[model samples]
Target: MSHVHRDRKKLLTRVRRIGGQVAALERALQGEADCSDVLVQIAAAKGAMQALMIEVLKGHLNEHVVAGKTEAVRAREAEAIMQLLGRYAR
Candidate 1:
């Protein structure tokens, strides 16, 4: 629990950074950036988003969902998160 608490901050920070990057990308697009430039920003935003999910999912699995024998609960959480991640991954 203590360990889990510690790592959550980093995960949150990463996600917030990604959110900021997304906002920046939005602003860039609104400013009529070139097509290739917009695409580059979008690809970067997608990568950041993917990284955020990966960090959070791995943390949860390492700390909460996989630390005990709550098979049903872990399964539920894992399935839900993985489903959401699956869409993002594609």
Candidate 2:
């Protein structure tokens, strides 16, 4: 099975938490919360998103790159990861 499938439950839990953070951010904006409070919410949501991305990236590297059966397959996975990082970095 793929790493994503193996880690589905854990990933889903993180996603749900991120969703809650986003919802809180929305509510803060709607409620005209203090600027500092809104900023804190924004930071929390951003950190959660980054954490999720890192987890998935790590899994992809481990399963598809490090443990790949062939050098060609590993190279392909590395290129895909590089492409993803390029987009993400911008």
Candidate 3:
């Protein structure tokens, strides 16, 4: 079974929390909050998103790369993940 399948609830909870953070950011903007407060909220939302990304990445690594049946499959998985990481970094 996939790691996500096993941990769906936990992952969904993270997603919901990130959504809430985004909603809070939207409200802050709509309310014409102070520039510094809005920036702080943006930072919080970014951090939450990054945390969710890391969680999903960890599941992908464990399920597809580390636990893959063959070296070629593992290498391919790792390569794909690295490519995504490269894009994300930019």
Candidate 4:
């Protein structure tokens, strides 16, 4: 968990910036900014969100999921990972 603290912080910051980008997108739309510019902002927000998701998934796989020591625990980790993959895939 401590190992991921830095990554978590980075992800949090990314998310916060994405939120700002969303607000900017709204303003751009109302201000009649160029369509391309508004779409670029939207795409940036989506990329930030996807990056955050990847960070979380990597943390899980590298920590709790891989650190499992027992068959049952490993199985549960696999299940958790499967569920996460499903969500992310969609």
Root-mean-square deviation (CA) per prediction: 2.8, 0.7, 0.9, 2.1
Which 10-residue span in candidate 3 carries the lowest summed lDDT?
1-10
Return the top candidate by TM-score.
2
What TM-score, to 2 decimals, does candidate 3 have? Answer: 0.93
Show the lowest summed lDDT stretch of 10 residues, model 2.
23-32
Badly placed stretches (over 4 Å) of model 4 are 1-8
lDDT of 3 by residue, 1-90 (tens): 788889899989988998898898899999979999899989998998898899889999989998999999999999999999999999
Highest lDDT: give the candidate number. 2
Candidates sorted on lDDT, descending: 2, 3, 4, 1
Clashes of 4: 0
Local distance difference test, each candidate? 0.78, 0.97, 0.91, 0.82
Off by over 4 Å in 1: 2-4, 70-90
Candidate 4, residues 1-90, lDDT tens digits: the string is 454675767877878988998999999999979999999989988888888788777877767667777778878988988987898788
How does model 3 fare in lDDT?
0.91
| Candidate 2 segments whose C-alpha is farther than 4 A from its true place | none
Q: For candidate 2, write residues 13-83 as lDDT tens digits.
A: 99999999999999999997999999999999999999999999999999999999999999999999999
Off by over 4 Å in 3: none
lDDT score at residue 21, model 2, on the 0-100 scale: 100
- Model 2 gets an lDDT of 0.97
Backbone clash pairs for candidate 4 read none
